[model samples]
Target: MTAIPSAMRVIDVPKPGGPDALTLAERPVPAFGDDDVLIRVAAAGLNRADVLQRRGAYPSPPGAPPNPGLEAAGTVAAAGRNVREFKVGDRVCALLQGGGYSEYVAVNVGQVLPIPGSLDFIEAASLPETYFTVWSNLYEFGRLQRGETLLVHGGSSGIGISAIQLAKALGSTVFTTVGTDDKASFCEQLGATRAINYKTQDFVAEIAALTANKGVNVVLDMVGGSYVARNLQVLATEGRLVMIATQGGAKGEIDVLRIMQQRLVVTGSTLRTRAVEFKREMKQRLLQHVWPLIADGTLRPVVDKVFDLADAPAAHAHMESSTHKGKIILKVGG
Candidate 1:
């Protein structure tokens, strides 16, 4: 095994502000625990959560690195004493509690997975955060099933794209809302039965018409605020509303009568704060179900753009613009 380095380059958010607040700096290599593996990062995935973290609206969980990053693909550089699933020299991608922007990061073994042979490091880097979030919310909490209809908000974003593909692969019909005509078309090509342009149409009304007023069985909503009430209006009886983000606004008004009348379930989750055991179970499920699709080209991550580690600010700027259609990545190390 190669010797661990004492210091590594990392993107630091020195203050709460815009993309330019992200600065390149050097930090000590993170230490690993008994059940952890130290990864030599090849690439890092950018997420909206990172943007929130940068702006100080969202903070890293306790014990997580102060730097902003949630997922990465890399080669295992070292393994903790109790880590049996991976070893030095193995290529992997990981769901991180934090610190993925660095050259190396120590992650719990349970959060790590082997990179598919068919995917390069950049593509593998995009998988963990979006795939895990979609799987856990759409399949588990949302209770989506074959033949059920689903509505996904922000349809061209990383999480939305994953949800669209996975729902379609599982035989659920999908409708998604995007901001532009081009993005709507992009979502349809990714298997959305219909992509509603939220800028030019009322998603609630469009969904009502498309479903003959019967409504969809599930709604994956990232935009909160007024969307909550509208989502309730568009959900079928016994439907589920899974809230992953409140990009629009955190507060939402809902009609208690509506929820009860439709037997609707409103749920949501954040992947970074989940326990290691829980992530282990999620990783197992992905390996059993989704990885094959990724390997065989039945599913592919949409990488809208990539930046060098030093240019993280530009990457974040692009993401905040809300014009990109898929995941943005940072090429960190070889």
Candidate 2:
């Protein structure tokens, strides 16, 4: 093994505030436990969760670092005695609870996966948080199946793009909502059957028209609040509505009678707080099912832009602008 550095630089959230609150600091490299592996991070993926963490709306899980990153890709620096899946020098990407915004992070072995030969560090870094979340919610929880119809909100966002591609690749017809014409075009190019521009059209009406008034089988939602009732209205019988985030707002009103009448199922989840065992199971499923598609070029990660580690604040600002088409990344190391 190469000599590990005693200290490394990390982006820290000094307090709950805006993007400028993110600042750089030096800290000791994290140590791995019996089931953990220490990774020398090359790049980190940015997510809306990180924005919430920076603003104090989302808190890190117990034992996670104060830093706000949720996924990273890099080479393994060391492995704990009990870790057998990965060893030093292996290239891997990880789903992290926190601390990915640093030069090195200690991750549980089960939450890590080998980087596919076709993907570079930045692209691999973009996979874990979005892929895991999309798979867990869209298939595991939402129960999306082949020939089913799915409506995905935020078509140009990382999770949205992942959902669109995965659903299409799995033989489902997908409809999505985007903020602009460019984003709509991007979503269609990525295989969305239709991309509704939310600013110019009502998604519920669009879905109703597109599905010929029969409605869709599942709705993958990130914008909650006002969308809850509308989402409920656009579901077919026994349809599933899976909520991953409440980007619009947390509170919403829904019709219980309508839910009962339509036999609709409303469910949601957050990935970071899930148990290691659950993530391990997800990792296994991805390796068996999704990794092959990624490896063979049937599916690919869409990167809108990348920023240097020291420019994390700019990255956050760009994300908040909501203008980027896909995943935003931070290059942390070579």
Candidate 3:
């Protein structure tokens, strides 16, 4: 095959606010190193992190790609000599640290996963970042178990949707908090046992009453701030609270006595800055356990909308509106 010229659309620095912050510019495409693969990105998913990165708030990791996207689905255009698991033309999606908002992106082989037969390019693109986050935070860190109750905040957000599906499939009683009635219904259709409208409902009291005051075994929160204190109120003894993002602000005081008395575990992780080895381990675990479920269609990406690559600004706007019920994608190669 002839080597295709590298191409990209750059989002200029210091995006102030709104979708306009994400703009497009032509640039040279990236090259792959040994053990990496050159991918022709078919689509990329819009993530909150991407929005934050565009605003100069979320700094790119050291040695991370200049682009802001965190996940994409594409075909292998060129495989490095050391790559053994994939070859040219294989459809795949990758969990990326950066650079996914492009025509093509080079990714380490370890970060790429075979696209499940059940998913198309756009759907596949939406899976990696959210799925990996949900799996890592809810189960690996939170230790959510079967028969236990789990509460997911932002039930309509990408991570929230993922948590709802995976938790339900794993036999946990799933509860989610959504900002709108439509979002609440969407979460229910996605297998959430209970969907509370956070705008009108008291999530803590709702969960407590719903669970007969036993409280939940796991709390997946991206909303921090005052949520830190309320989260403890809804957590059963030995429960875990996994904080992935602080959308509601970070700094706040929590009752230390509540944590100690409840024996609750509190921890969180950000995937972008993690070591390559850590990501590779997560990739392996997902492939071994979650891939099969995805293949069988029990696990699916709840795609709320798709936008043309050129309309990434609009997609970002939709995300900022907080109305989309699931993953928002940017379709390329149109």
How many pairs of residues collide in each model? 0, 0, 2
Candidate 3 lDDT by residue in tens digits, 61-164: 87878767899998898989999999998999999988888888888998999998768999999989988888888878898888999999999888988888
Instruction: Mark the regions of model 3 whose C-alpha exceeds 4 Å error after superposition.
Output: 10-16
- Compose the digit string of candidate 1's lDDT tens values, residues 191-280: 999999988999989999999999999999999998999999999999999999999999999999999887889889888898999999
lDDT agreement with native, every candidate: 0.94, 0.95, 0.86
- Cα RMSD, each candidate: 0.8, 0.7, 1.3
Top candidate on lDDT is 2
Model 2, runs deviating above 4 Å: none
Instruction: State how far residue 297 of model 1 sits from its true place (Å).
Output: 0.9
Query: For model 2, what is the error of residue 211's alpha carbon versus the real structure, in angstroms, after optimal superposition?
Result: 0.8
- Output the lDDT of residue 230, model 2: 95
TM-score of each prediction: 0.99, 0.99, 0.97
Q: Where is model 1 more than 4 Å wrong at Cα?
A: none
**In model 1, what lDDT does residue 8 have?**
99
